[model samples]
Every structure is written in C-alpha cells, then in structure tokens.
Target: MRLEGYVIVSGDGMLADAGGSMPDSLKFEADYRFFSTALDAVDVVVHGRKSFEDQPNSPRRRRVIVTGKVASLADDPGNAKATLWNPAGAPFEAACAHAGVTEGIAAIIGGPGVFAMFLGRYDTFWLSQAPRVRVPGGHGVFPGVPERSPEDILRASGLHPTDTRVLDPAADVRVTAWRRS
Candidate 1:
C-alpha cells in the first residue's frame, strides 16, 4: 500500500496564520487546486483530532480521525463524510482495511503529532510551500520534527523536489511538490 500526504503551508512553514486564520482567498484557491490534484491520487485520509476539528466539515473521502474518544458524525453535526476511530485501539492499517483502502494512497493531513506517528510509514509526501509570511508564534511546517531547516527534513525523508511554481509572488508564496524517491 502506498501512503501519501500533503500540506499547504506558508514560506515560513506555517500551515495557518496566527490564530488559525484560513488561508487568504488567493491562497485558498491555490490550495484547493493542489488539494484536488493530490486527493485524486489517494483513497483515504487520516488526520488527528485537532486537524479534524480545524476543518469546517469532513471531506468526501474515507476519512479517519485518530482520537481517544469514539467519534460520531452526529456528535459533530458537520462531519458527514468521516469515520472516527482511536488509533491506539484500532491501528491505522486496520482502519484502512475496514475502509476497503488496503492499497494505493492514504493521505495523512497534518496536526504534527499525527504526522510524527505515521511519518515512518508513508511512502510519499506532497507539500506546497507557499511564499514566506512572518507570523509570530505561529505553527511551523512540521511541528514535531524538531526545529530544523525544512529543506534538511525533506531531504532526510527521501523526498526530492519534483516541481515548483509561483503562486501570487506578490503574496510571497509558491507551491512546490516533493516526491519520495
């Protein structure tokens, strides 16, 4: 099975601006385009409880949220497209099996700790490096990966830059994708 992940972050490595602000309208549009492209290559998505909460609603894919509390769509009211489970009790592989996604891509969206838990298991990572924006005390690229240059981590993870394109240079963001070799 191929496990894939994607993230849209600012140049400074912040996924969201301070206070969890949504990406700017332009950035959001670009993100949706990248998301649609990346998502087309996967069948399932695994996220942490925090990431799940951050989203307005569950996406239209076989979604899994790793949480200690049993998740119910009714409980969230807005999460109509996901099934929640406890990763500790039901391993991620088992959950994927139950979702009938035993092969192909499994995209792990971020929330740092979630990525840390499954980083070693993923086969590829698709990341979009938006132009640099300074956000004081905001979240960085990979929260738990120890403070280091993003380039270093990407290289260490066996991912090589496959493509790069400017997205509103005036906004100081560009979208870049890296693939595992």
Candidate 2:
C-alpha cells in the first residue's frame, strides 16, 4: 500500500493538451527514461481509464485501471497484464491482490483524477517539469482541485520536495521528488 505518484507537466502546470493527451512537444527521452526507471521499482502501476487507454503498451508487469464500468479484473481482456478495478466496488488492497501484487510501491501514473485519488497517501511524488513547454487551455495535473500549483497541492497534502535532479538539460526538464514528511 505504499502509494507513489508520477507526473510530467509543463511550465504552466499542464499535464495534457486540450485534447486530453500528453503534448507531443513535451516528449523527451530523458523524461521518459526517468519515468521508466521509476516504474521499474514499483510492483503495481495505477492509472485512470483515460491514461491507461492512452498507453496501449507499457513496461509495467501489473496494472490496475480504475474504472467504474468493471467490477473486477476479469473485465479487461485487451491487456492480459492489467486488471480492471472499480475502487468503489473493491478496496485498493483487493485490487493489488487481483493484480498479483502483494506488497511494494504502487505507482500512480496520471490523468488528473488518479493523481487526486492519492492526494494525501503518496509516499513520494516524482514531479517532472518541462520548462519551455506551455499548454495553454491544457489540463492540469489535478484538474478538479481548487486552482493551485502542483507543488502547492502536494505541499498541502503534506508532501515536500526533498530532492531534485535534471532529467534533460537540453529540454530544460527536471524532476523533483516530493516525499511525505
């Protein structure tokens, strides 16, 4: 039940374009590398239906796609590696068990709602920033929440930026890990 989160946002705090997809201009090898590396250390990957569907393929061995349409893991057949989960119907632990993930970090990859679900529960949040990119009318990382910077939202949830690293200098992208204090 160690929930961790990851998001790559633009300078204007946008996680997705107007079309609700990641901006093509923001794609950088270094940012992707950091995300892949973070996923390597997690046992289960968690995301909303939009994010899950957007990524037809992934490196994650086990994933739980949060959706109200399905009651259990057997509902999703497109990806044998993933388990469909309705949080309203089953507990998080049960979803993990259904995914064959008994214990370890559960990485919450985004689409806003999924990130908000783990608001106060994230053990760590790896927030990567693309400084030069700005998605104006784009979706915020936590869409429905009150207007606040991603850093402020994380801080309000009791997570503080404890460490930072440059992921791609050429793209001016850097990642910061916010750990729960």
Candidate 3:
C-alpha cells in the first residue's frame, strides 16, 4: 500500500501557533486547493484528532483517527465513515481494514505526533513551506523543533526531495515531494 504524508508548516517549522490554532499566515487559497485535490485521491486518511481535514467530503470520507481513547479499532461516534484506532491495541493493517482500506494511498495528515509515527513508512511526503511566515511559540511539525528542522528529520528517515511545485510564488508558498532515498 502507498503511504503518503501531507503538511504545511511555517519557516520556523510550526504547524500552528502556541495557542494550538492555525494562524492566518498559513492559510493560502492555492495551498488549500492543492491539498484538497491531493486528499481526494487517497483511499483513506490517518490522523490524530487535531489533524482531521475539514473538507466538504469529510463526512463520508474514510478515515482512521489515531487515538488512545479506544482499545483497538472502533467506529467513530461522530462520523460513520471514520474509525478510532489505537496502535497500541491493534495493528495498523487492522485499522486500515476497519477503515475500509485494503490497499491504495493512505494519507497521513498531522498534528506532530501523528506525522512522527509514520516517518519511516511514508512512500512520499508532500511538505509545503511558507518560509516568510513565523509562528512564534507555535507547534512544530515534528517532535523536536527550532533545534532540528523538519527537513532534517525527514532526511534522517531516508526521504529526500524529489520535486518542487510552486503553489504561490508571491507568498513564497512551495511544496516539495519527498520520496524514499
């Protein structure tokens, strides 16, 4: 199965501000369209609660939410097409099967922890960066921040940039596809 990750972070490597909210600076129309289109092709999306994509089709889209609240895998109370998966109690394949996925792309969206969990499994990681944006006292895309770059961690995980797509040249918003080295 193909596993992919998608995230947009500030130059400082932040996913959101310290208040745990996405700042206006990270919102770009081009990026949104790109992300949404990419998501539409995935068979299933795996994420933590905070990483759930708020898209129009989210209600019916297959999803596996990584959470400790469930012992194994359980149907999501909020969404019929979603499942709550606890890796500690159930295997990933089981979660995927429960989420109605046997193969195809499994998109890993993030809230840091979720992104780090699949670091080594990603077949491709699409990283979007807004170099000019800085979210002071914000959440890093990975576990360790300002000290180590997200690119550094991705490199360590055996992924390298394979291509770049300029989403918004004016805002310096660009996305690079990282593939296994």
Ranking by lDDT: 3, 2, 1
- Model 2: pairs clashing at backbone N, Cα or C within 3 Å: none
Worst 10 residues of 1 by lDDT: 71-80
Each candidate: RMSD: 3.9, 2.2, 0.8
Give the runs in model 1 whose Cα sits over 4 Å from its true position: 17-26, 52-59, 71-81, 144-146, 169-172
Q: Write the per-residue lDDT of candidate 1 for residues 1-181, one digit (tens) a residue.
A: 7777777665556665556553463255556666766665678788776563233323566676667776322123446546566766677777777666677777888666666566566676666665554455566657542266555677776777778777555665566666676
Q: Rate the local accuracy (lDDT) of all candidates.
A: 0.63, 0.83, 0.92
Query: lDDT value for candidate 2?
Result: 0.83
Ranking by TM-score: 3, 2, 1
Per-prediction TM-score? 0.76, 0.91, 0.97
Tens digit per residue, CA lDDT, model 3, 43-156:
999989877678897776799999999999999888889989999999989999998899999999888998999999999999999999999999999999878999999999
For candidate 3, the clash count comes to: 0
* lDDT for 73 (candidate 1): 22
lDDT of 3 at 162: 96
- In model 1, how large is the Cα lDDT of residue 125? 67
In the predicted model 1, the residue pairs found to clash are 130-173, 131-172, 131-173, 131-174
lDDT per residue (tens digit) for residues 116-170 in model 2: 9889899999999997998988899985432678889899899999989998888
